[model samples]
Target chain A: MDAMVEQGPEGSFVLGKVDDLLNLARKNSLWYMLFGTACCAIELMQTGGPRSDADRFGMVFRATPRQSDTLILAGTITYKMASRIRLLYEQMAEPKYVIAMGSCANTGGLFQESYAVVNGGDLFLPVDVYIPGCPPRSESLIEGLMLIQQKIEKEPWLKKAWTNTKNPKDPQIEGLL
Target chain B: MTSEALIDYVKGLLGDKTKWADPEAGDNFLTVASEDWKNICQTLATDKKCSLTYLRNFTGTDYPEDDEIELTAHTFSYSEKHGLIIKTRISREAAVCDTLSKIWPAAIWYEREIFDLLGVSFNNHPDLRRILMPEDWVGHPLRKDYKQQETYRGIPTTRPA
Candidate 1:
């Protein structure tokens, strides 16, 4: 059984530690939350859908935030839902990385002038990768996911914000409403 | 029913408050006062004959120097219903409008979005929260006068040299 295999020292040990096990968990599975809120959400769906098949890259859509390892803030974020977004970011477990997907999430795209759009997703969470577009083509989202996977492999410490944001000393920022 | 008759019927309810802006790109638009937006939306959505069951989308634009914000609500009517784009302008200073969420549940999210990005307060929206930005995000990102924040989501955004 895979569980029995995982328990074997040779299966998980790397230089006499469980580093290989950690690497295996990080590499084989990365569940993402469906946080699409706008047009970019469409493109994001396309990435995971049949045509793009992001499963090849080890990304699967997650129904709940708790189970997901990554969050894709894929759309224009407005002030009204900004707090809820922050809460969602908090709900995500440790070692989570947020990917700002599309122009709306990255820079508010065309709706940047409208009263309700959040100019950028970064204002709410630390973004590991920013995929730009009015709604970036599906290809762009794929590339962004790959790049994020690369980042996760390189610097796992980037998750510090998810924990640091909870500190009392963290600045409370203002909003439109 | 013809467009003229429908316009006339709406004129009966809104009276002098409705003005038909010239149609462009094959769509007819009507401009109404921000105060009357709720009532007008109800009439359009609930009326059995002129049932506009779908709210296509809405976006707000801020004109700071002029002290006005323009909200454009695009609605699609199922019947005789040629597409109608309703536009209403409100002064930026006291930008307040009744929430249309009561009539169209979908408007709750759209209205919240408008309030979130524009800083306009919807008088009676059931729940108002930021949709796209972080909870601690400062300032409405879309306002023309908005200043670029240096740090967003722990990412440092640099200005052009």
Candidate 2:
């Protein structure tokens, strides 16, 4: 019955549940970039392995950021690597999501005191989800990914919560800016 | 040859150049004045008896309290089947050294890394740039007196903990 919807100029008025259908499709197929720089990468790979296969959620790894909708930062981000991270985020298509996987990418972990490491990826990127662990287990990462899917389903298209025009109002985010 | 004989041979070649020698130390370590560093290194590399042809590692140490920086090079010889250590102490005020990259091509990256982390300048290096740190980074972070910057390019660097 949904397939019988009119394809003419008045298609918008004919399709009442278009937003719900679009959100469902977008939430399912999230192509993530396979760009990990440290130990957290091991856990990320395990998430894609047989036991906790990410393919079950329609998640797959993409080599290039341009084709991917999600960026899974699965390791330590150093001062030298922050520019490259920002560049990759820019290359990704619109309506993208960032998942800070592990304590290193979320907040520098054991290397917090070091002079070279970046404190957190949120300082440079608009992170949508954070998975906390020195190196979060595969189960934990999958849980975080599910949370992102939920957030995607909840977002409104016309009055989107994310905006590039201004930084977030949160003090921590503002301080980073 | 044994480590003792190798140290003795290097010490003899360094003759007046040897500032300090530690034959009984844990490792065959010795220190030389910066002025004679190049000449001693050249002899160790070219001379058949003291053939320290393979450059294993080259690095620097910071001594802020004494206002000095020490650069050390570890080399081994396949022909002689032995190793030698050559180190030089330079004042922090003028931390410059003759480049060994010409002698050992591998020293190129090592020299650049030392310069990047310890602020030691290498004269006549082919291409000297930061190896581990960002190009525009302000100070040598490995230096004992280094203070971590609060921010970088508007990004807060301090940890939230």
Candidate 3:
């Protein structure tokens, strides 16, 4: 349904309605899981700290995956930790989002050649937004959160994300363990 | 005590069992055969003249050209305030050496680390398992000829070629 609007003498302005209201609510209250794997974790903590204050955007961290709507992967993902990441992603509610918060989580960064590191978070769980930098600054993470909010505002509650949210070729990266 | 004096003291106890390492080098480091490792370590730790009571560092290095892995142990005596560098070489085909864990106590974990990285086995080691790598890891990464597996679980161990 089209958003309601009332005609003013000078111009027209849309009225707050059911769909717009849902979008507003969804965009504001994004509870992300409290998770970090490496150096990027320090930046993640700074994002939640007073100066950067992610809480101003209505973003707070949940202790468990089940209660959170977002996952901010804040470091390197080794083959050993990939399965646990998958399990955490699966535990989140259906309308979940993932933020790959640093170069390591995005493309394995310095550890790319390492025999143990996973190339990217998307290899195991679908990543919605990727924040670059070996370890992205706290402000960058806040910007990433804002982008997730923008995405939530445009997306419908029942509709799946437009981007393909599929686990890569293999569910688990096979190794000794 | 100086390194030279320390070398002489060890020689007095073990006689021909120990020898000055690297004849060309002036350092007092001593090298013992793999078969004499356990006995030399015990005598050095217990005997009053040379009590190497503390195990400062115990590690292994791979020598691919020589086809042997060298195990080095650095021990110190709190009473004497002197240290000794003991080394033993084991064949790469069967990189096994006696465990000094019983004498040094602190050597148990170091022995496990050597076993983990360089694939050097310690005879009679209480728990010889991978200490740095995952327990299920295929091969010792520190070995000179180690070949990383193509995939661990289902994830490619390397970046796209």
DockQ of each: 0.11, 0.37, 0.48
lDDT string for model 3 (B78-132, tens) is 9899998888899998888889888988999999999888888888899988877
Off by over 4 Å in 2: A1-16, A158-177, B23-25
Kindly give the stretch of ten consecutive residues in candidate 2 chain A with the minimal lDDT sum. A168-177
- Per-chain TM-score of candidate 1, chain B: 0.84
Worst 10 residues of 1 chain B by lDDT: B152-161
lDDT by residue for model 3 (A1-177), tens: 356788999999887655567878888899888899999998888888899889999999999998998999999988767877877876787678889999999888888877778888876666889999989999899889889988878776655454325445534433322
Query: In model 3, where do residues sit more than 4 Å from their true spots?
Result: A1-17, A161-177, B22-28
Give the best candidate by TM-score: 2
CA shift of A113, model 1, Å:
2.1
Task: Please state how well chain A of candidate 2 matches the true chain A, as a TM-score.
Answer: 0.82
| Candidate 2, pairs of clashing residues | none
Residue A122 Cα positional deviation in candidate 1, in Å, after optimal superposition: 1.1
* Top DockQ prediction, candidate number: 3
Greater-lDDT candidate between 1 and 3 = 3
